[model samples]
Target: MKIGVYSYFIKNQARIFTALVLTGILSVSSGLTLIKDARAASANLSLETSSDVSKDNTKSNRLPRPVANAVLQDLASREGISTRELKITNYNQQTWSNGCLELPQPDEACTEALVSGWRVVVSNGRENWIYHTDSNGRSLRLASANTPSNQLPTSIKNAVLQAASKRLQQPISQLTIVESQQQTWRNGCLELANPDEFCTQALVPGWRVVVSGRQQTLVYHTNQTGSVVRLNQKPNQSTLTPVTIPVSELPPPLDRDVVFRQISSGGFAGTTYETVLLRNGQLIRVRIGDANDSERSVRRVSVQQVRQFLRSLERYKFTQFRNLSYPAPGGAADYITYTLTSQKNTVQYNDISQNNLPSNLQVVVKAWNQITASAQ
Candidate 1:
């Protein structure tokens, strides 16, 4: 009886130990399931919470409101969530369609506006509005225009942007300004890949200092001296300034009746001058003379300027010159073409085109040595 009781106690203890081990395995499996479920739920919530502005079609529904909302509802149902949270607060989305937006509210830092057709979105930061277009104005990822004010000297930025814009045939509207920093002119010079001499020559005409953003995109214009300017890619340089010359300083039209006095020792001596003595329509005293002329008359005047003096003369007159061939100096089988202006006996031989002549023919000037004499 004593041996049987001891064996029964040992058997009971073994059974109890086995039961505890099984319970622990079941508990671990249950905890794993709970953890997986919680993670799955969190992932679903995150996916549904993202904004409907994705450009990728796989991520969200098409635009134009009703469709987007329907797609949102479908997504919510699949995730076992209520549609109430998915309701778009601002479906008007005028800011998303047109590139127009008011200044950011007190708490907000920046406002984004979508530029139609470009897929480009512009963000208006504290100081300036940045564009989302790429170097060529093709649609590109949205980016900011912020540069620490101290980084690039405003001068470097301005020059690079203006040069790039002119080179790329792109409007400032399409450039995305990424990073801008202060840089010395020497450090920022770009080595052009194609080396277009004509385009490069225009890089900094007249003393223009350019302010550019990170991509060397032009943002503003200034003079070489670094005065703030307001020119926006104007080909004509005159339009950039503010000073308007009043008409008071202009010289009055020369009076045909008043004989002009000649200074004996001036730059005008000995030269024949054509002046508008009585320019009542192209009829000027065609025989005006400089101070040195044996016959002294009025001093020489520009034909165009004279027309400007008397507008009526412009209609009656036109410029004419004569092109003719002349004998060559060397007497070889060669001749030169000369152009004689209507008023002057002087002949000018153009030297530029002689190289392009055929091998059999050579070009030379006949009376070129006598140009000064001809004028006399």
Candidate 2:
């Protein structure tokens, strides 16, 4: 089925926005929890450093130059937008489907396909990340938002980025030149686009291209500095927006040592299914097969149902079990796996049996622990 432009942006924006919120929430929590104990806790809360400069504790890793440039160029041309106006809220290098950008227009044929396995970035002060095909599902866009940028609606960024990514001809590294500038001075003023320039970077006040990664020469701009300058000096916390917390960003309790005390074994077998259980995030549930079975039945359970079940089982705090099967005698057995956010819970069910258990329960527990660990 065909989707609309707004719908397309909304879908992708939701993914990026949800992650941004989660990161903010976690950063805040970390600041509150750790800053008191750590001497340079303030530095810890900052996420401004480029992902490449491993020196700072704040920045996410940088994307390869080719991919980062592609995302920038795509945002400029396809979305009829520019990087200065765009906030690198996220830079995820994960496998995403092409169907995401296929928006329904009055003319369905107008829809287009994007590269799969791309990085997704949430536009600054927006909800969704512009996606591209790269990285092990890690984001390339660096989230550096502030009060001024946050003032804009997520839809605006989505609309602009969607338009930009749709028309990308070549990656950013190949581009002859790249530039960023601020367009607006007033706080309440809306963003004005001027295609003549790469993009009008006016979301936040004192706006400038604080960080630029190019093939020939990298540049980093800052509010204190006026224009695109050399890529020197580490990105400081002052360059970023005060982090806000999203339920998704918070560390999952499942990651804690308490979550995996004793997991025997587990595997996601059979069919796979994903649903928009959360207004923001996705809930994926998989059905496991019996030991070496051909296939397992899969279904998308409600987020509410998953939450209720988890809450009910909360009394089993710190308890861990793997290969625990709730049999469906005539059908496949059900194995339970779950991920949670403040807004929703995702549950996965698979047909599983003792035989499917790994060589050691410790391994299973560790695997499960990793899932939660990554979330945290």
Candidate 3:
């Protein structure tokens, strides 16, 4: 849908991403336990440095430069502001069914053939605007929002980011926002007051922000203005509003050539996301646990590459992780527990021990992360 004037027709694959998920809250319980500790996360300093530089470039990446520049100039001209004052929050590639990009002007005649273009979401940190354009943006159209939405929703997004940056003691540029959901808490503690902490006994409207850093992810809860921010360390659910937004399940594989499947959940929001990779190198992702997730994404890679990966799994004795439930240690909170499924064998682990996981499990996580990044 559009943000300001016009809209692009979205495809079905775009709908595949918003689906179901869940979690297992295993602590010091009297049950089967297989706890794993995390190793330090590795990083390529050069890549990280270069990546940050691109954000400042403000001229490329997912949104083509021509389209982005055109959208910027048009919005700036219309709003009577500088192009620098505008930002593009989102952009997605699209294949329109008609020359009009599926949005024709009143009584206008248009060609009836498929066309490739983009649906761009631009904002001035106030109202969001959507612009549709051809591949190179030689043609453009602006449409109003389908359901009007504030670009930053009262700037709470920034407030929570700052809070999380302070909490992690990391540079703000190094952090990524995974998700933000509007919520009403049962208490003033944002439903995460510790046993020893004091909290007001009344409902409070706020937001749940999921922030991701190089080695960790966390939840920051805040009021409308983000003036009262809290780390959600102990989520209290009894009186809290059910924050789960119902989503569809991932579509089944075309065949039974399954390689492995992974399901992850647990943040302050306590929602699940899933992914699956087939032997033919068809990777499908749904309800991803990362920032700015789409409904779903699918990518096809070299079958030889997938075969090589399976061989690597064999080298690591993949079956050794079967039925292993890598337990979460005591006092762990906001950790995303990951479960791996292959054939009849199932293994579970969590973000707490992601980097230090068993080689068999580690390979799967690392490979899938890479695949997901490339798909993005």
- Give the top-scoring candidate (lDDT): 3
| lDDT pick, better of 1 and 2 | 2
lDDT of each prediction vs. the true structure?
0.33, 0.35, 0.65
Regions of model 3 farther than 4 Å from truth: 1-255, 288-294
Q: Show model 1 residue runs off by greater than 4 Å.
A: 51-376
Alpha-carbon deviation at 91 in model 1, angstroms: 19
Put down candidate 3 lDDT per residue, 1-376, tens digits, no spaces: 2643333234433443332111223333323343222111224566677888987675544677888999899766444456987899999888988887766643246799888999999887766778888898888776551111312354676777788788889988877664455678899887777779998999998787766676666777887678888887654332121111112322333336667687877878888778787766778878855676776778876665664565455445455444545556668788987777665356666776665564456787676676656642
Would you estimate the TM-scores of all the predictions?
0.20, 0.17, 0.30
- The C-alpha RMSD in Å for every predicted model, in order, reads 26.9, 37.3, 37.1
Which is better, 1 or 3, measured by TM-score?
Answer: 3
Report the lDDT tens digits of candidate 2 across residue range 1-376: 3568778988999999999999999999998877576746555555435443565533344555666666666544323344676665655445433333322211123224443454557363543444544343332332221122323223332332232333344343332212233433332122332335354344544333311122122223323223222222343332221112233533344321121112122335423321122211123232333355433222333333433333333222111221122222235434542322222121212233333332232243333444333331
